[model samples]
Target: MDLLMKSLKIGVNEKLYIKDPESSTLGKNIVEQSILMIDEMGFDNFTFKKLGVKINSNESSIYRYFENKHKLLLYLATWYWGWVEYRMVFATNGISDPVKKLEKAVEILTQNVEEDSSISHVNEVVLNRLVINEYSKSYLVKEVNQENKDGYFVVYKRLVNRLSEMIAAVDGKYPYPISLASNVMEGALHQYFLKENFPTLTNCNDSITPTEFFTNLIFRTLNQNIHG
Candidate 1:
């Protein structure tokens, strides 16, 4: 499901009614605009007043949708993960073969990185910082818990599990491990993105698109590790 559809389902399950289409759109707009602002200003420097001006909506209107700036950030993060999940689902749909499915998953994720550079950059900077801050300080722990319960992690866990199943399908004796695959996938992409785009980092002319690099790397690594 797309982020909006997922959000609507959650709202319905929670007995909340959108009631007003304009209000619903406005709230979503606020969250999206807030993320963009957080991207440009960094989370620490972003403020409700600044977001208000950017969205052309008053602070009171924003507060009506979100209790506070922290809540807004949480919602934005949730929406982001929702969008990622949506893309993954779309990319994996109609693929039945395990190996093909796994390849497609890698392709989708890598292509997503290049397809939406702005959102990808925002996710790298703002959402990652928030996750790290929460992990380090243990603040917002409860909010993170709530977000997970709302199916954000559920979708990712399912994806990983499916990938693991595919690996097992390919090689009967293979040690199918979702966590290991996930770590490898994320680590490779993080290195690529940081080196290519992050300021103050050494630039490497890797020149390879994420899809090409990941497709070859993942297939080769899996084949060597599991089949060799």
Candidate 2:
């Protein structure tokens, strides 16, 4: 898996970037530093100029890689979803049992992210936190309709569809596979956020994880849909 990941390039939408950040050192630095900065300062407070100062480059250089910080956020979100899709494919590969395959997919999607050493420039752990905390900012705007039309969110939608297919594989009769799959993905993020900020509102914590919660919820609903 490590060797495969090392060779793999998680592709983001070309329209999201002025220049691909993975193509050069400075561009990579901008991505790396910006992830950390956004994770630390939150997206509303983050700026390309601040990222440039941290990377010892002019703000204009950052713009060369991205039109604006919103685009950069979209780039990061797309890249992260692409990476998830790759892992989901790898983890479920050759698994014959539909239930087992769906179980593994849930685990991969909801499990706590550890830094993947295969990609040294971007930290998966911090990027995961950024996605959980700030990913909505990338799309929750008046321009979302246009951006969606422009394919800015193709990777994310594809990821959801992949999960939706896995759900359908497990339960052929399940009527709301897409909704369930999307809820698992988005709900895991909300559960994580609640676990951090409003512990009482969520049942997930160190002992009871969001992965376990969602896994249980999925199979239970499917079983009932099948039998009841």
Candidate 3:
């Protein structure tokens, strides 16, 4: 009877055992496999079965960590944000000048897009379709609304504000509005990405890359603001 009670106590504390090295490694493996599958099949097409096969585990094992596909995608999205934040922090580290900061920020953005082409493509497709096709779906609508309420756009706004303050610091008499310039810069990047990836509608040649276009346009915008 004492042995039985001890066993029950151990069972109850099994989650505490999750700190064990083997269990931690298994957990990392699951997330790593999920990311691999997402990069290969994209978020929409990724399935528990696929991840299970990839990790040599089963659907039940994945469900132990993630509640469902939506939860898994959320995890992936959060992971992507972590990656972006890491890059942004490293890229902007030690840069105090506002104009230099803005330039570095734009450079980081372009480099991130370039480095994570597959993930970026998947995100673009999902976000674009969500805005158009799935807005009426409750989950989709809620996700989109939540993103607008608390995600990248907020970060972007803060970055813009920083850039504006930097611009103000540089020149007291500068006429170009920072907020407007930030919007234009973001718009230019979006348009450049779309045109580079979907040139048929954009009516532009495929010779130019998004990075190239973004670099040129960003410098041109800054130049115009300073000169014109």
Candidate 4:
């Protein structure tokens, strides 16, 4: 019955970590506390030593899981993308309209995350904030090309592909489904950054949201191409 009752799981790329962070208590602490610390202090100041103290584990123990904080950040970002894709699927499932599914997918990507108790160790809210603020920095490094070769980005690409298919289903001839999907993902995060720092720069009012903003943009762009 336990096998029948198994919970949903999100998997990050194994190549990004020396050990899976979900396998034990100490490993789970490294993930859960790292998310809290990185969210509290920016990534530059976050270290395995500091995380060790916070989690009451040796620095070496944390190192057993990740090579460095950069890899940890990559791991977190990958996990978050998988989580977002999970939420997107749940939000859009059983909805027959492809366009409506795409709209829900946009909202899932853009809206603020709330804590989910099912995955008790990982806090989706802080993880979401971290992704919005720090996700791009995870890949904007000199080693990004090398990391890409290692499949560090598969989960992110999976989300893009999943979303792009929705676009293709809505309008098979839509010339830029991949580009638009990528834009919608990054633009949603960018809007949160803008809204948090420079609210005046965006029209993301309480009534009109970043999700609405991008949803309209995607539909209009695709529809225009369809009619032309």
Candidate 5:
């Protein structure tokens, strides 16, 4: 898996950046430090100027890679989804049972993220936190319609579609596969947020994880037995 990830280059939309952050050392530093800064400070307070200071470069240098902080956030979010899709494919590669495959997929999506040692520059752990906390901001904007038309969110959409297909495979008669798949993905993040900030609102504590809840919900919704 390490070798596979190292060899793999998670592609972001070319339109999302002025330059590809993965193409150069300085560009890579911009991406790496931005993830750390955004996770530490929160995306609303994060800025390219702050990131440039952290990376020891001028603010203009950061702009050479990304047009603005919003674009940078979109880049990070898109990259994270691409990485997730890779993990999903790798995890369920040989599983013949669709139920088991869908269960594993849910586990991958809802479980807390751990750092991947294969990718040294980007911290998957911190990036995951950023996604959980700030992913909605990336698209909840006035330009969202234009951005969507430009394919800035293809990676995320693809991940959802993959999960949707898995749900369909498991239960061919399930009418709301896509709707349920999307809800699982979005609900996991919301549940994590609730677990962190509003503990009283969510049952996902140290023992009761979002994974277990979603797994149970999926099987029950499809009228399938997990142990079957």
Candidate 6:
């Protein structure tokens, strides 16, 4: 996503919020600075009290929007996926060929994020970093089944289903469309995670982007099996 890309705005799910953070300055600060802080310090060390002190607000004020840090993380993940879906929709608006559209969707899912001004409070770049590092925690929790039932995972499912449709369009009999779609998303992040901290574990080198790597990977796998 281009840091300078315009008009890519989206809203977080209401189920993820106790009160809409975008409605108030203090709430916005909680969402904005929390992303920055969590991305910097990692999620386990993050707290509303610390975020409150950083944002120059009270702990109680931050709690007014989020039940806990976990819910806030859920909010961030929900927002990120919704925003990604928006990007996919916008990027492939007029595309006809399923292969080309699927490739573009992979690019949207895997590309590096830059700062976006669509929202005044959150930085998409840092939020994407948090998603890369901390996304699994959002759903890899004990309450995940309950949260999934509550529709917290709808945006993510929508993104995968959208791409799976494109995959199915290209090859109606493709049996692994949904699994492949989810892999493209998760695998791209996994590659980025490996490259960022454990460079020796991956060949992500300085030339090819994770986006390009996964796009090529998916197309290659699909091409080999899509027609046969």
lDDT of 2 by residue, 159-209 (tens): 789889989998899999999998998999999999999999999988999
Task: In candidate 1, list every pair of residues with a backbone clash.
Answer: none
Q: Candidates' lDDT values, in order?
A: 0.55, 0.91, 0.50, 0.86, 0.90, 0.85
Better of 2 and 3 by lDDT: 2
How many residue-pair clashes does candidate 5 contain?
0
lDDT of 6 by residue, 14-71 (tens): 8778899877878878888899999999999998889988988789988889889999
Of models 1 and 4, which has the larger TM-score? 4
Superposed Cα deviation of residue 156, candidate 2 (Å): 1.1
- Highest-TM-score candidate: 2
Worst 10 residues of 2 by lDDT: 111-120
In the range 1-228, model 5's lDDT, one tens digit per residue, is 878887788888899999888889999888888999999999989988888889899999888888889999999999999989999999999999998999999999888897664586788988999999999999999999999999999988888999999999988777888999999999999999999999999989999999999999998888853334
Which whole-number lDDT from 0 to 100 does residue 102 have in model 2?
95
- The Cα error of candidate 4 at residue 24, in Å, is 0.8
- The RMSD (Cα, Å) of candidate 6 is 2.2
Evaluated at residue 191, the lDDT of candidate 2 is 93
Q: Which runs in model 5 stand beyond 4 Å of their true positions?
A: 224-228
Per-residue lDDT, model 5, residue 115, is: 62
Runs with alpha carbons beyond 4 Å of true place in candidate 4: 1-6
Give the TM-score (vs. native) of candidate 2.
Answer: 0.97
Best by lDDT: 2
By descending lDDT, how would the candidates be arranged?
2, 5, 4, 6, 1, 3
The residue pairs that clash in candidate 2, if any, are none
User: 1-228, model 4: which lDDT tens digit per residue?
Assistant: 223213657788888899998888888888899999999998888889999999888899888999889999999999888878877887798889988888888888877776554476788778999998899989999999999999999989888888899999899999889999998888889998988899999998668788889988999998898898
Model 4 per-residue lDDT at 19: 90
Candidate 3 least-lDDT 10 residues: 8-17
Poorly placed runs, candidate 2 (over 4 Å): none
TM-score of each: 0.66, 0.97, 0.56, 0.93, 0.96, 0.93
**Candidate 6 off by > 4 Å:** 1-9, 115-118
3 against 5, candidate with superior TM-score: 5
